[model samples]
Every structure is written in C-alpha cells, then in structure tokens.
Target: MKNIYDLIIEDSEKFKDYFLNDEDHPLRYFPKFNSINIIVGANNCGKSRFMRQLMSLNSYDGINDLLLIRELIDEYNLYVEMFNIDKIQTFIDKYSRNIAGGTILDQKAVKIQKNRLIKLKEGDFKNIISVINGNKKKLDEMLGYSGMQDDFLKDYSKIEDTYSKEFKPKKYYIPTLRTAHSLFQIIKHGSEKKLDVPGTNDYEKIEKDIFLHTYLQNYRIDKSVQIFTGLHLYRDILNSRNSEKSIRIQFENFEKFLSVNFFDSKQIDIVAKFDKNDNEKGINESELILIHVEGEKETRKLYDLGDGVQALIVLMYKIFMSEPESFIFIDEPELNLHPGMQRLFLEQITSNKDLINKKLKYIISTHSNHFLDLTIEKEDVSIYLFSQRKNELNDKQFIVKNVNRGDNSLLKDLGVNNSSVFMANCSIWVEGISDRNYLKAFLKSYCDSIGKSYPKEDIDFAFFEYAGSNIDHYIFEDEVEKEDVEIVLKDIKALAISNRIFLLADCDASKQSSKKGIRLKELEDAKTDNFIPKIVWNIREVENLLTNEMWKEILIELCNKTLVKSHEAEILLKIDKALSEVNYSDFAKKYVGEFLEEIRKKMGKISSRFILNRSAYEVKSEESFGTIINKRELSELVFNKNFSWEILSRNNEIEQLTIEIYNFITQKQ
Candidate 1:
C-alpha cells in the first residue's frame, strides 16, 4: 500500500565511519513515502554522486553499512515495541532506587544485577535480529502471534533460513543518449558461433548493410544485415512474419500511447526488411526500419527524426525491457525533450503498465520544472530539492528537502523571488480539466436554483485540478533554517494546506464501489472519518454525468452539426448504433469509443461542414477521438446552461460535489 524508505543518506564514505564509530550520531528516519524518488539539486551538488553512493553502498560487508540503508534496525524496533523479552525490567528501576538509597542489597551486588539486566536486553535484541528477514509474516509469527505460527509453517523458506542475503533491489542505469543515437549495433545471430576475423566481411564487425541497403548475401552467413540489431524487436522477432505479428500490436498501441503523451499529430510508420529467406530461422537476419510519415511524397529515415522523437522510442524500449524491481537512474533525461513532452514522458513511464510490465523505480535527476507540475494531489512520488549550505563551522553539508505543491517556500527554492504564500480559507481539488469545467457548470446551476450567488474563483473559492495522471507528489519535510521560528511541516503538505479542503476523485472506473490508490483511500477516510469536504465520483469521471439520454442528445447534436443535411436520418441511426454499445456503468473512454467507431465508419470520406467550413477540431482517421473532439469545450457548451447536471435525475454525483463546494464557500463567506 505504501513505498517505504526507512533511511536515505548521502556520501556513504564520509558518513560510514561516523555512523559506525560514533553511536551517538543523531539518526534520521523517513515516514512511509512514495515509490518514484527524484533528486534535483544545484550544479555540483552531488546529485549523481548520491546515486553512485547508494548503488555502491552494498559492496561493503559491515554492520554499519547494513545499519545505514537496511530496514533491519527499523523492523527490530517495531517488533520489540509491540512485544517484550522479559518482565524482569519492570522492577530493575526499583533495584536502582534501593541501591541509590542503600536499602536493598549491597551496592556492588545491585549494580552487578542491573548490568546483567542490561546485557540480557542486548541479547534479547540480538535474538530477535537473528529471525528478522524481510518477511513480515514470519517475524510476526515467530514472536508468538498464535494463528500465524501455523501459517508460518507453510512457507518452508521462512523456517529454513532467517538470515537471507542482504535486501537490495536490482539496479540499471540508462546508457548515455550519445550511445543510443546511432540506433544500431550488429551482433551475430546464428545456430553456431561465428567469430569475426579481422579482415573478413562478417556482419558482426564489417557492418555496412544498413547504409548500403544491400541484402543479396548467400544463405545464412553473417556477412551483413540488421541495422537495428541492437533494438528489442530485432532480437525478439527473428523472421518477417513473427516480426510483423509482434510489431502489429506495437503499431496498434503506438498511436494510442502517443495520444496519451500528447503527440497526436506525429505519424510514424514501421518499414521492416527480413533476411531474404522469410522462413529461414536457422541463421537468418532481420533489419528493423522506421519511416517518419509527414506526407505521401515526403518521408524521412530514423536518424532524420528529431532527437526528442528518437529519445522517446529509445526510452520506451529501455524501460519495457528493464528487469522487474529495478532502479533506473536517469540523469538529465529532459535535455532532449521539450517541457510538454517532459511531463507526458514521466506520466507515461509511471502509469503505462501494458508496455512496461516490470516494476521499475525511476530516480531521475533533472533541472526541468515540468515534471514538478502542480503535484499537490499526487500520490506515491517524492521530489527532493537538494542544496548545499555551510554549517556552523563553515563546512559544506548536503541538504535534501522533500518539496510539495502546498509549501510556499518551494517557490523560493525554485528561484521565484517575489511570490508570497497563499492561504485560502476554502479549496476544492479535482482530477482533470473537464472535471473542473463540469463542476463549475453544476455550481452555477445549483447556486442559481437556491437563489444564492455562485462563489467566485480564486476569491470566494479556490478550485484546483490535479491535472489527470499528474496528481502524485510527496509529503513535505522542511530543511530550511527557521531563524529561531518554528514551522509546522504537516500544515505545509498538500493535504493540510487549507483549513477546509475538498478532494474530488474519480472511482477510476472502479465505479465508486471500491476504493483504490493511497491518496484516494486517504481522501475517502478524510471525508468519512475526519469530515473533510472530499468526495469520490460515483461515475468514472465528471463527463460521465451524462446518462444514456444525455449521451443520445449530445451525440445526435454532434452528428447533425457534422454530417450532411440529407444524411440526417442515417446519422440518427448511427447515433443509436453507438448508444447500443455503451455500458452505462463504465467510464467515458469505454462508452465513447463505440460512438467514435460508429461515427468514423460512416463519416470517413464525408467531411462535415462544421469541420471543413470553420476552424473546429479536425477529424483524422488514424488519430484519437480526444484529438478529434474537444471534451472540455463540449462540456462547457452543452452542459453549462443545460441545468440537467444539478437535477440528480440520474443520481447527481456532480451535484453533490457542487453542494460540498457551495457549503465550504458559503461558510467561508
């Protein structure tokens, strides 16, 4: 449920001896944190050095090394707090008191008894340490939890060896972009080992087939081929048919992935060439080709594409191929990509589970602020601002501060000089643009119905959107010198920023029945248990407030606006066909897909007057419906004055959300 890092330390060598020899050194431990940990620091502030230190920290075999990064000490502490070794310590204080008063036994004897108790406590800790692995169930049962002991017996490995290897997640650093730009390396692919003699024309060494475009070699000799031999597709798919079949799925999903990443207009085509013998798997070669499709007459090679484009492809390939439970340390990945692409890239890498099945922990060090876009409602990610300041003795010390969207001090750290803190009386945080738009419409409609003026934005109310897929930032931990003043960190974290705050979340297509995600569950508990003004949507998103009739009306209007006048009856039929496929219980993306497909099938060649006559959203065949239709515009145009949003005719989740906002704003006023 949470990503926990018990401790994070920097410059392992400089502090290793201090922690080992000086037991009095102060300890710093973190609360349960998110998974994606980023390190952004000033130039030469040990950003890359922190990565190197953590990776090599495990090479040493000392107790302090384990003490620093390992969660073993924390586990032992939690275990002992719940259960004690012996009850004898209860009276040890009495013994000490009597010895000091010269009333119990002789002074030396009593002192010896206390010493024995101290040694006994230390031994008890050591005994507990011997059984502490990463396995929680085993530790619980071993400490005499009754029923768990029977279940503990089932896991054979737990009983066999309590002291396993030191826990370290796998690590994989991305190769430099300079190495990836070439985009190809030739390796031998055959049944037997084919060594490259110095002068011979073997493809392993003398690889010029890609530039020469020559594949007229004899049967299965490594003379030439495989320009993209280094890529995953070339290695996995050995022949033409298999390559096409595998890439067909990629081709199917590539466009959608691009859509999510905001690359809607860009078109890429796969141009592949197999070994001359398509079925000859014995010693065959495959060359993966890519074409940049700008138009029918204009095409470009992979190298001809922009660096950001190539980096996107390369980054996905590397991430997808990464082993599970690995750390991918990427330094300055935003160098080639623009600001928009930077945000989209992080969003894609974090959530795209289909393309990336493995569990990867990305630790990117960057100078770009786009990745830190409005992370107030974000869950399971931490953005630590690294800075170095001189200590009391004028010695340099590293400082890592967990930054959140609510902290006004973060603006100062990011080099904004003039902005002051914002303390709103009441606030509402939603997930997306359309959610905000829909809520505003309902608020207006509801407030009008009740004869109360609607709350003004940023004055009477502060409406914040978590910018879909961008709602996951960390809890703030302060590092600035208070200058003899006390600052409460909890008050600065996003959740506690405003005195009365509302968090509006979608069910995420769990359909509001079950709760999922760390922040969503936290917000739910806040609303139910803490009486915070947060609500989870019953439907998937605010756009889904439109029921079947609402959808039919909207789709019919869209058809009438777009299609030819003579085809009105036929367009109505298509709208019905689209509505027949909709599952009312699901989200907009699911139900809207059917409408898009049916509309596209009949309206492909027929350009509508709304699209052609004026500058509305363009409808492209191979593009996404999102790019084709503006959902935000549609919500504002259709539902703003519709008054149906606040009616609750189909259960007004949005109307109820509007009520929470209204109450907050009214009380504040």
Candidate 2:
C-alpha cells in the first residue's frame, strides 16, 4: 500500500556539473515524479527534453559513463594516426589508450605537479627531484626528468595540460528535448545507441501507453464496470468511397490484439446512460450518436462536443468505470472544457465514496484557479507549480508556489476545488429542501431494500437550492484547477424520487406566460424510475381523498399494507406539514426528531448551517443520529424490500456475471 506519491522526484540545482551544457540543465534539474505530470513551458525551455529524461530514468537503473570513453578513444586515435604503422615496436605501441601506458602518463603528470608544489611550499628549488621522488627513482625516470631548473620548470606547462586531460569525466545518458523522438529507440537498442533525444516517437508511445493502460485496459476493456471506453468513436459509411482521412484512437485489447476503427469517426459522439440498472448494460460495448440542442439551429458534431464535455466523458470513464485500483493521471484536465464543467468534474470525482473504497488514485495537473476553489479537503492532494528564475536558464518545478490557500479563502472565493478544502467522495447534489427531504427518506428505503443498509456518513447528499443546471455553470466559473467530474445525471432522478412518495405533492414543468402559467409538455414526457408511482396530482388530489385532516390516515393504511408498523403513520403527516412551512432541515429536527447530530457524525460536522441550508436548527453537539431513518419501511409499502447488493465478494468474472443477473432481476418491473 505505497502512496502514489512514492514517485516524487527531488529538485535539481544547475551550474554544478561541468559536463552539462545549458540544454542539459533542466533535464538534470528536477527529479522524476509519479502520477500524470503536465510539464508546461514555452518553446525552447527544454520541457520536451525533461520528459525524455524521465523516460530514460525509467528505462535504465545504473550505468555511469562520463567523458572516460571519449577521452581514451580520442587520445589513442591521435597516437595511432601520428605513427601510421601497421605494426610498431613493442614499447612504443604499449603507449596505446587501451593499455596501461595511459596510466603511466597520468603517473608522470602527478609526480611533476608534486615536485613543483614541494619546491613552492618549502621555498627551495634545490634537489627538487631528489626530495620529491626519494627512492621511487623508476617513477622519476618514467617521467623523463632532466636536472635543469629552468628546463623542468618550462615542462610544467605540458604536465598541467596532461593532468587536465587525465581528470576528464566518464560518459552517461543525458536526455535532451531535441532528441526526445528517440525515447523508445534507446529502450529498444539499449543505452549503447546514440539517443535521438526529444523524438516524438517516444512521446507517441507514452501517450499510447497511457491511453491503453488507463483508458483501454482499465476502462473500456474492463467488463465488470460495463464501461465501453471506446464508445466515443464512430465510423459512418456515407457512400462507397472509403474515408481518406479519419481521426481516431486505436489500442490493444485484453486479448493482446490490436483493434483499429474500434470507435467511430469523431463525427458521432456517444455517452453511456445509466438508470437504476446501472450494472445491467453492455460490459464493454456501447453506442454512438449526436446530441441536438433544443433551439440551436445546428446539431452538435461528435467531435464538436465542447472540450469540457470530451474531458468530462474521458474523466468519468477513468474514475468511475475503470478498474477499482487503477491509477488516474489527468494532464491539464480543465483543457477544452468550460470553467463550469471544470468544477463539476472536480465535485463529481471527489464526492464519490465508491472510488475511495476501491483505493483509486488520481494525479491531476491544472493551471486553472477555478479548478482549485471547490476542494473539500487538502490532505488528499498536493498542489504544485512550475516557475523559472530570472537569472536561471531553466525554470524550477515544485509542489507549491507563493499562494497558500490555508490562510485565506482564495480557493473558496475563487472556487478552486482542491481536494484539501473541498469534499472528495460520493456526493448527491439536490435542488432545495423538498428534494433533499424526500431523497433522504427515499435513499434510506432504497439502501435498506438492497440489504446493505445505506450508511449516511459515507454518502453525502447536498442541496443546491433550485439552481438548475446553472449549478454546473457556477462550479465551472468558480475555479480553474485539475478536478475530474465523474458523472452528471439530469434532475429527472431527483424529481421521480420526490414525487413517488408524497414528499412532493405534484410535479410540474411550467413557465410564466403572459399573465398565465403554461405547463411544458417536455416535463411530462420525462421518464421516471419504474419503481416509483405514476400518480401526478397537486395537494388538492390528496386532500380530496383524505380531506387533509385524515391525510395521515391514508399514509397509515399504506404503511400497514406494507407491514411497516414499527414507525407511527402520524409522523409522516407531521413531517409533510412542517416541510410545507419550513425547510427540510428544520422540519426533520423540529418535528420528526434531531437528525443532524447523527448526520453530522456521518457526514463531517454541519460547519455553517449554510452548507446544507439549515442555519436555523441548532442540532445538539453531542450524540449522533445518522441511523434514525430506514428505507425498508417505505420500500415494503411500495414494493419488495428483501433485495441484496452483495452478489459476490470478489470482483472476478463470475462475480460480474452474477451481478448482471441480479441487476436485471431487481431492475425489472
């Protein structure tokens, strides 16, 4: 269970290595890090080469070679070319670079410097060789020293030059942006090959590998999640002519076979729709099409989906549908998507507990402040920035810059969804008190019917106060950081749950018309979960049947039929009355009972009542009441409540198959 941060790389200091050229500074400056790192720099800053160095480090473990190979080879070639003899006398030929003759020359240079230093230190030049060599006369003779003070001194220049040459460094792999194209070449040919440095071949392979492993194998190719990672692609045969140009992504499958045209041309966009039967759809199969805007004159081209939509879909595929333990590396996730979608993506990914339970990991690199503002927690993530010093040739890279959100509300006011300040788990965003009140009750019933009682602490359902899809726009405009939105479901599900029980007396789609309200047909056409009742009527309908005074009587009869006698029926009537006058928060505590102390324990504290829109009710500071509500009571009244979610213990093929069967049966009417 090593943290993903194990890939953290240490920073580098330039201007130290004599062998490093100006271009090599950045490559050696930053240590390699883990997760998906987005290296940003203007052209010529060596960012590409930095990437190459990372690849090289990953390719080889240890092999240090500096200028040693070149110095020896060059010196030997100089001597051989100077003589031009096919065969030489044994002694002269022994002076070759490959032999110890190089070492003899090095020894001679060292002796000369030692004697000169001795003369200078003692302030005496007399008997220099006698004092320096002493009994090591062979070393002195090998140096070929003559007893002339001026001549020995004049030869000092030659010894200095030789000493400099002897101190030359060895050879080593130093990746360069210019040679990045050859990333895979070095891997394939081994370190012996001249690195092509900064070649696109390597970049292409890395990109392919990421898409294959994270998107293909773990997402689209994963059968258990029923995600078709390649659903975004489309191919249309307009006529007999084959397409001359096609933009598509291809990758290897689980069977180790290359699949081309796996997705259709970008012309048709596809999105996987999930219902109550979220697990019953195609395991690795999907469909592709286009979405037509209501009043827009043109249809949205599949490729034309906003970059935010594209980014969101891909992010969702990775975080939600991929393998539970997969590593998620998102590079500039906010790219192409609108600022609002950026926040939406962040909120979605961080709020889902299913991901945390699976031990999934996410490394996102973002430059947008909007992406940073919505974060709920800081410990789960690290923020970093890449900056260059004015005097330094290469820019510096580190986890954080000058801005510290800890002391200020910059992240909140600016709406950055850094995992630190924002919640990053399963979140169900609702609109207003009515929806919140009803969903809480309905979700309890839903979870209980499924056997694994829904634990309120792990799941949070937040209300956005009737903001509509504009909530999406708000989250986007709020921050610009690397947050991934896992999924965005329409409001239909919330409305259905609200109406099914009497939480909402009637559901209507209406707009203010000239002095009159006009009901919208689209709202009626909207679909609802089959488990929900189809009675759509105002409070008058219920009052007409029970006359309001005995409204709880009808509920009691309904509960009795379902065998939910543990809970009194009058509580339901009192709850509705309180809900009509006050918010769900106040109604829950004032009438039904204090639910916040329990809810607070489950979902962190209420903080400011404004967080969940219940600033009025003062929930007790002690004791927890998260388990007060139960879903079986309601489910038994409407349908069956003996269903179970534990179809299998392990996430294997057989378990997935069993889940498919179970989901199909439970989802059926």
Candidate 3:
C-alpha cells in the first residue's frame, strides 16, 4: 500500500490541471491528518466547507474505478490483437471434412461409387455451410458478444464488486445540535427532500441527507423506515433458533457503550419500539423507552432525558455503530454540555478503547475552550483556529492558525487569567533586561526616523533571564538541564501561538572567540529546535552600537560631570586619544571596562540591592552612556536629521536583523 503522503503527492501532481473558480481546489489545502483534529473558529469561517471537501476527497472512488476499467479494456484489446482467425477457420474446415467422409474404403463404398459424384458435390456445399455456422457460434462464445446494455452491466458489476472488497471508510457527519429524535425521524419517514428545501435555515440538512442516503444504501434499503424496524430485525435474528453469535455480540457491544456513556442508572433498560396503533406515520410516535427495574417503576421515553444526555447518546450511537476506519465529523460536540461536562465528554470520546482500537478519525469543530483545554499536551491531536480576513480588494479569506500544545495564547483568548505576558500583537524575547530596554528604545527611534508612528502597546517586550544569558542557551552551546529546556521551550511555544515571537540574541564574546560572530547560521540552527524567528546582533552588545563620535562626546561629558577639578580641554584630549586608539571590536568594553571595575570594588560600600538597581542609572548619569537607553531620549537622538541608520544598515548582519524585526511588528498592524 502506498503511504498517504505519497498518494497525496502523486495524485496532486497527476491532477494539477483541475481547478475550482480558477483556483487549485480539491487538494489545495489538504491538512495533515492526525488521529484527532480540532478546528475552532468563529461562525461562518468555512470550517464546515473545509470538512466537506475532505469528505469529498475520501468518497472519490470514481477515479480509481475508471482507471481499473481502462486497464481491463487495454488487456481485452491486446487479447483481440493477438487472436488467430485463420487458425480457427482451418480447425473448423478439418472437423467438417472428417465428419463428411471416413478414412476406410469398403465394398459399400464401391457400391456407392456410382452416386459418388453427386454425393461429393452435395457434401462439399453442406460442409462449407456447417463450418461457417460453427465458426460464427465459436467466435460469439469466445468474445461473449453483447449489446450496449449488457456490456455496461458487465463492467459496472466488476467495478462495484472491486469497490466493495476495497476497505473504504464510511463517513458520518453529526452536525451541530443534532438530536437522536430528529435523526430517527429523518430515517423513518424518508422526508429528506421535504426537510432539505431550498434556502433552509439549517445548512446541515443536506449533509444529513447525504449521510442517511449512504447509510441506507449500504444496507441495500431503498427507502427510510422506523428505527425499531431495523432494531427488530437484529433482535429477531438474536432470538431465532438458528441465530448468528456474531450478530448477537455486536448488538451487545453497542448496548454496553450506551449503558456506560449515556445512562446514569443501572436499573434502566432501553428499547426501541413503535406505536403501531397511531394513525399518523411519523417518528414522533416511535419511542426509545427506558424501563426501570423490570416494569416495577414507570418507563420513561428517550425524550425525557436532558438535552445534554440526549446529545451524547446520539453522538455515541453514531460513533460506536459506525463502520470501522470511519471518518466522523461532529460540529461542536460541546453544544449542550456544561463546561465541566464538556471536558468529561471529550475525555470519554478520546479514551474509549473500542473507538481507539477501531482507528476512527475525528474532525470536531467547536467554540468551547473547555473542549480545547482537554487537548493540550496530547499527542496525535491537532488544533486549528480559523479567522476571516479581507484582502486589499476586500475579498474575504480564512486564515488558519495551528495552535501548538501548551500554547498560552489559546488560554488567553479563552479568557483564562493565568497568562504571564501582556497581550500584544507582536512579541520579542531578548537576552536580558538591558537588551529588551534597548530594542524597545531603538524601535521607537527607528519608527520616528522612517516617519512612522510607533504603537508602544502593540508590541510585547520580554526577556529570558531564568538562566543567565538564556539567549546563549538557545543560540549556542550551554549546560541547560533537560527540565529547564522544557520550561524554556514551553514558554516559547506559548508565546508563538498568537504572537509572532522573535528571539533577539546579543552578539557577545567576539574578536578572540572561536564561534562565528553573531551570524544568521546561529539563528538558523536555533530555529531547528525552537521553530521561531530569531535575530543576532552584529556588534558585541547593545552598548557597542554607540558610534565613535557618540562615544567621544559621552566620555567628554562624563569627565566634566565626575571629574569636578578636571579641565574640559584635558578631558577632550584624553577622549580623542581613546577614540582613535580604540577599534570598534572592543570599543564598548574599552570605555566602560575600568569604570565597571571601579564600581565593582565599591560594591561592599553600598547595599547590593541598591547598587544592582542603580547600576544602569549610574552608568548613564556619571558615565554619560545609559546601559538601558530611555525610549524618548533615544528616539529624539536617532530621529535627528543628521542621524542616519544607513551606516547601520550597511552592516549586513544588523541590517537584516533590524529589517526582519521591523517587518514582523509592522505587518501585524
């Protein structure tokens, strides 16, 4: 058997010419099939249409049947081409001659010699006529010659028999708010056409009719009948003197499922029965009665059950009674169930041993988050969230977003209060507080410089400080434990579901380091594991972004502020000498190296907490270079007409990273 993926790829290539509305249709968006797939979207986001397309794909056996017929026809044509008509005629002639005359000659032959001329002439003509007739009959028998109707029936029978032997799943669609009573009515009265009138409010009526037609056709039933009529046949077989044990066992299993999932009381026994005395022919007169303790208590009908229970009964009946390997589509299984019950209902469906063993595939469209919550951390389950968006020309299209396991955004969207990060259109995860503050300030400035307004609240800023330099743990080799890796991965996955998460790693430890300095390769490698977009800086750190001129000015101001007795001219000479001697490679460390060491030595003189909190402030105030740049000040500085990011853009690494981040946030708007 071909793998499903191989089949999809092969069929897609073979059928690429087919189109719908001038767009690739059938297999255009074939979703990756899993054991269970959950589709959640607002109303009318095309979830039902997408599911129907999948059903159509599954039911498409016509192509295979056609291919089979073509192959048989080719074989028949080859047989005809190889046939020897002359050889068959020779055999017929030989048989005719043997019958017309004997090999032996006797006294009788001599006596008949007088009439031999007349007899021989007559025998020759008769033998020729007999050979022609025999040849015609033999040819007809060999070819099985037939009219158009006979030929069509023969081929159709072959196709039907072959299709029946091939194990194709029966598809059952249980639309939203489907009730057992309504389904029973549809099946009993055969009112499908009446119920499926044009422009009906219930869009699922047509789908239900299709499902019912396929089901009844499978049983070789031409018309709808009461539920009890079908059940009665099964019961009669079970009670018959010559009963099939398999039939009894199958019915027993179905009853067991109902008792376990639907009924709350063990004393209640359910039975399908019809009120034969009623004049009206409708499903309303048909009843599924629940008998209590052998008629000691009054029996209750199925309608007496709560809506939620009835819904479950209908869903389970469809599932358990469905043919194995069936594709079951249920729209909003959580429809009538409460929040807690919804979770329990999902748990029951997913955990059922019979359902699991049968290898049933389920596609459920739901609006309930409780149902979604039950799927988190589950393997073989996929969740898709659909949204409708308009293009530039105002044409609407659905955008499907896959919700990863343990995604926090799903919880947030469902109104859960446990999310730690603030809601935003875009999120950026950086290495440290300094990097976060710097990028936020830089973005604001970059926007202003480009004459674009920056929406501060629209972007979420976060840092990975759980492990010192957590960014390095992700971008480079590190000793992060397995548990810590899982935690970090979960957080990353959670943020990525709704927000576009970009990792910003500082390009540190260059010049003498063996590592490739902050390059795209690092981000690419990280992507294999985290599967999120990332950026690495070209400079060693955010502080290194300060230009040589900016460095000189900052140093000059720092000396004027800290060195109360130092002359301005002296400070300028020292600053100019430092700027000229320092290469961009180690410029940030060169200027702040001694100053940071001085502050470290005085750490014991001040409270550790105060020093830690005031560290960035001290660098900005006394050293005239803020470790955490203020957004407004940085925006003003970078937006100056003389200031240009062109030089920064010239650096390929920083340029690409900046552009990626800029595009990511802007596109969300």
Candidate 4:
C-alpha cells in the first residue's frame, strides 16, 4: 500500500506547494484511514484548512511525473548539487549497491520501508568520478553515461521521501466538515450551478454557454470537473432512484440523524417542477420540500426556518445523499449546541450503525471537549491536534501532532483550565484528593438537605494540598524560629492560597495536635478570619466520617473482592469487636483512631489486599505513606458506589461545618 500514497513528504514538490506546513513534518498521508478522524487545536490553527486538503483525496491521483516537464538544464542544476567532489564519492561509498555496499544504517528491511536500492556501475566508477566538469549535464557528456541517471536520482529521492512520510501508526489513519448553508437555487453557468460532488466523465465537450433552463450542446462529462449543474444532478438522482426504496432509504437516514428538538417529526421529499415562463423546458430544477414543526404543527420550507437546526437539515441532506466515501467537515460543531446535544451529535456520527456500516469517514475540527474524549480511545478513531503559529519569515508554520488514545495531555489542559486560580473566590486546603472527594460529596449532601445550591468547583471554591503530617517534621507556620530564611513566604502560605481559606486538618492524637501548638494555632492565630480552621477533632482522618455501619459494609465488600486467608464470619466478628469499643455516644470527644487501627489490623489478618476497582488493587500497608493514585479509586468506591451522603448530610457536626464552609468561601466578607 506504499504505492497508495505518493512518495512525497513535507519539503518535496507535492506537500511544499500545497501546504506551507512544517517543513520537516514526518507524515503527510495514510493509505487506509480509520473510520473517524478528528482534528483539534486552538482557534485559527489551520485545522479546517488541513481538512480540505484531505478532502482533495477524492480528486488526487497518486504520484505521477511532475517529472520530464523539467528541462535538461533543470536536471543539470539538480545533479550538480549532488555531484560535490567529496560528497559524490561518499554518496557512492554509502548508497551504491556495489563497492561492498556500505552497511545500511538499519540491518533489517522491514515491510514498510522496503523499496528500491540503487546500483552503481563498478567499472565506470573511476571514469565517472573523474568527469566533474562542474556541471551535471556536462558530467553525463564527459563520462558518456545515459541521461536516465536523473531518473535514478528521482527514484531514490521518492524512496527516502516515502519512508519518512509514511507514519507507521498503530492502525491509525493518516489525516483525514463544514456544512454549506447556502440556499439551493436555480442553476447559472458558473460556480453556483455546478455540483459540489465529483462527477463521472464521459468525454463530452461543453458548449460555451449553458444555463439551467437550456443546454445548447450535450457536453461530454469529464470525470473530474463539475459536468452537471446542481439542478441536473438533483433530477438525475430522482430519475435513477427506485421510487419505493431509494428515496425512502434517504429519508430514513435523514430522520436517524435528526437531533430531537432540532426539528419536529418533519417530512422531506424531492419533487420536480417546471416554470410556466419556460414551459418548453421541462423540470427546471429539483426542489426539496422541508417540513418543520413549530408549536402549532406548522409546515415550513428550508428557506422558512433559520437556526443551526435548519442549516443542519440542509447540511444533513447533503451528507445523506453524498457520494460514497465523501468528506463531511464541520468547524466548531459545538456552536449553538448545548453540551448535552454536543454529546448526542457525537453519538450519532460515531456510533450510528448505518453511518458506520456505510464506512463514510468523518474529519471534524472542534474546539469543544465533549467530542475529544468521546472517540479518543476508540480503536478506529484518530485525532490530531494542530498547533499553528507564524515563524520569523511571517508565514504560518503548522505543527500537526497526533493525540494518542491514552495521552491525557489535552484533557489535563482542560483540568488545569477548570482550576484556574482566578476562577475561585476562596480555597479549601485538604490533605489529599480522597479528602477532597469526601468533602465535596458531603458538601453537596448538606446543600441538598437545606435546599441550597452547592458551590461549583473552581468558580466557587478550589482545593489545594494540605501538606499533611509532614508539617510535624518542620514548622512552616512557625514564626519566632524560622528554620529556612530562604523560604517562599513568612508563614504558612497555604493560609493565603486564595483570598480567603478554610483548612481541613485531621485531629491526630499526637501531642500538640488538639491544641494546634505549632500548626493551626500558629497559622490561624496570626490571621483569624483569613484562615478559618476545621481540625477534625476525634478522628485521625477523613475516612473516619463513614458511619460504623458503612465501614462494615465497605470492609465486607473489600474482603469479598480480594482473595483472603481468613473465614468471612471470623473477619465479621473482628470488625464488630472493633466497633463495639468505639462508643458512639462519645464519638465526638473520644479519639476514634484506636478503633480504626484495631479494624485495620483485623482486615490485614483476613486479607491485607483490597480491590479499589477492576484494574487497581493494593495492600493496606502500601497506602499509608505514598501519594496514592487510587485513594481516588477507593474514594470513589466509598462515596459513589457504597455509602450514600445520607449519614454525613444530617450529622449535626457536619451540618454546622458545611454551613460555615458555604458562607466563608462563597462571599467576600
């Protein structure tokens, strides 16, 4: 399939003239494209321009000779560049399939890179070497070699060019719609009258003058050009279509793609009508009857309604009736679409079995993230992010880089976007993501109980790391005896992570924790309102908030999931004994860490290992010290799947804490 694409790369004659893209771009085309190809980038990044180039494929004939057209003098100049005295001998020593054929840089000839190998005339080597008359054409005359030497050079150029341009993706298509909103009208002689689709050629010569109502001469169609007008093509489809199936199939597809609320239960039919003024000219053009349902079930023409939905109907009609493998490009398909509808559109385009069965490839450029992750991991989807900028030459230079399925760099960019510091009014300092997850769920539950709204992430509040127990080792908020004079701030800067802050720290049983001798007291005493404190008293960590019943459920599920050494009833008895000592009446005052520790020991004896999710599992010992990727996993399991926020929502202490947090972070004073 190497022959399927021209052996032309970025700097070569083909890619150079067409796209002034990155000169050293490694790829230009794919022989077989995946079912869906998405192009993404910042605005004005040439994603749309690149899509048009891929569309040119329908008209593209693979590499032929832009050869032979160059004069002998042109060939001479090119050969002269290749014929440097020192370099020419080196080229012969390196590439020549003779003189022991210098070892290839690659020892293996892989299937993709296999191509022509140049052979040198060994006997004429000395004669050819001595014939440097400083001119390429003159060298041929002096050495008496065939002029076909230039052909060999072109072949070698193309062979190297092919390898670099051919990207050996893991079954990824190389590169592969803007919809037209223009009203379909009567045919004129020029661009407006021509069909957008490529037409088959029959070699008929077109007359100088032809209009929709009249064709002076029956022009022989050229396979490439717009041989027939839009009207002519429309009539042609209806004429060829079997009245029972063809139009009905098209209607079915149109309905399938129709986004609900985009249009009502609408009807469409292609009808032929002739103008009485041009009575002799039958069937002046084909017209589409577009039905629309407004509130009153009123009928509307394509021209009557105006919205993206209307434009979409015309857009879809073109898509449904397009020639097989035709291109559909949409720029910012998210425009005017709610994020919900954007996802709906992605579903229809990517997963609609009919569209998939038809094997029509889509190359859409979008700024919306809804579509980015939608197909990023699908086996047959290829998304390339474009980076366009201008170079010192003041001409645009494009960087076309592929976004691999597993690469979340762009998604992380979106994540970072959602956490912009300016977007938040005040910040919450939590020790870890698991803490953040638990707190967020509890906050929402509190809001639900009071019929108040939960503040949005980032915009209302953001969470920064709390720096955990490490503060015990060295004092960050300690002032009188500052350990590091070169530190970034005078006191705990986490206090000022935003304009205002609320710190959620664990009430560990260690000395000075309850009093906050060196930590919260030092930090909060210095900046009262600026650093409100919530040292969760009586608990070692946020997980202690889970009710004893909830903990039992989680423990049981964890044992069931991971392989264990102890019997279920034995583990259950241990869990019950640990809880019996907790004494719920004194839960808010007595340290709960010992009970948790006892339960942890019991769980470990049964099965130290715990499954967080299908793909991630870990032993209890490993989670205590490191930054865990799946505290996140276990957090979701706790909050999302197992326990409801019901207990946390109504807990008197949490209710007070949630109310305080809501007021403190949401407004200025």
Question: How do all models score by TM-score?
Answer: 0.42, 0.28, 0.36, 0.39
lDDT of 2 by residue, 62-130 (tens): 101212213323443453445523322232333333234334233332222211211111111122222
Off by over 4 Å in 4: 1-421, 469-497, 513-517, 552-557, 560-629, 642-645, 650-653, 666-669
Candidate 4 lDDT tens digits, 519-594: 6555445546666767665555565566676566655554444343446667677667666655443443333333
**Against the true structure, candidate 2 has what lDDT?**
0.31
What is the alpha-carbon lDDT for the whole of candidate 1?
A: 0.47
Q: What are the per-residue Cα lDDT tens digits for candidate 1 across 1-669?
A: 223433433234444212211233421322223456666656766566555444443321112122322343454344345444353343345546655775524333223332333222221222222223223344344334333322221111111213654344456554332222323334454735444543222232223423223212311212211122223444332333254554546544554454333233345454544344323222224343445453546544455567777667656554554445555666677767755456546756654655445456666777555456534434556777766655477764566556664555555455544333344556777776666767766776676576454554444556676675554441222233565234443233454555556667665555334435555655555453113535454544555566656556655445434354666776666666656765444545333443444444544344433212212234444443322246666675544335553354354555566776677677732
Task: In model 1, state the lDDT of residue 418.
Answer: 35
- Please report how far candidate 2 places residue 653 from its true position, in Å: 44
- Candidate 3 residues 1-669, lDDT tens each? 011110122233323332222242323333334567888767777676555444545322111122333443344334435554442344344444544675322222112222221111111222222322333344344344331121221111112223467444566666653454423324323554456554321211122444445544653321212121122222232343133664445445556555543443233445545464323333224333443433356666666778777666666655666556667777778777755456445654665566676667788888766666567524567787765655577765666666676665665544556453244555666655455545544554455466554433323322333233444434232234676777566544333344355666554544423454444455555453223545344455555565555444444323323342434565466556655655444544443343332332333122222221233233534445334334233322432323345545544554566666777665632
Instruction: Specify the poorest-scoring 10-residue window by lDDT in model 4.
Output: 168-177
Clashing pairs in 4: 177-328, 177-329, 177-330, 178-329, 201-222, 201-223, 202-221, 204-220, 205-220, 630-633
Q: Which is the leading candidate under TM-score?
A: 1
On lDDT, the stronger of 1 and 2 is 1
Q: Model 3, 437: alpha-carbon shift in Å?
A: 43
What is candidate 4's CA lDDT for residue 205?
18
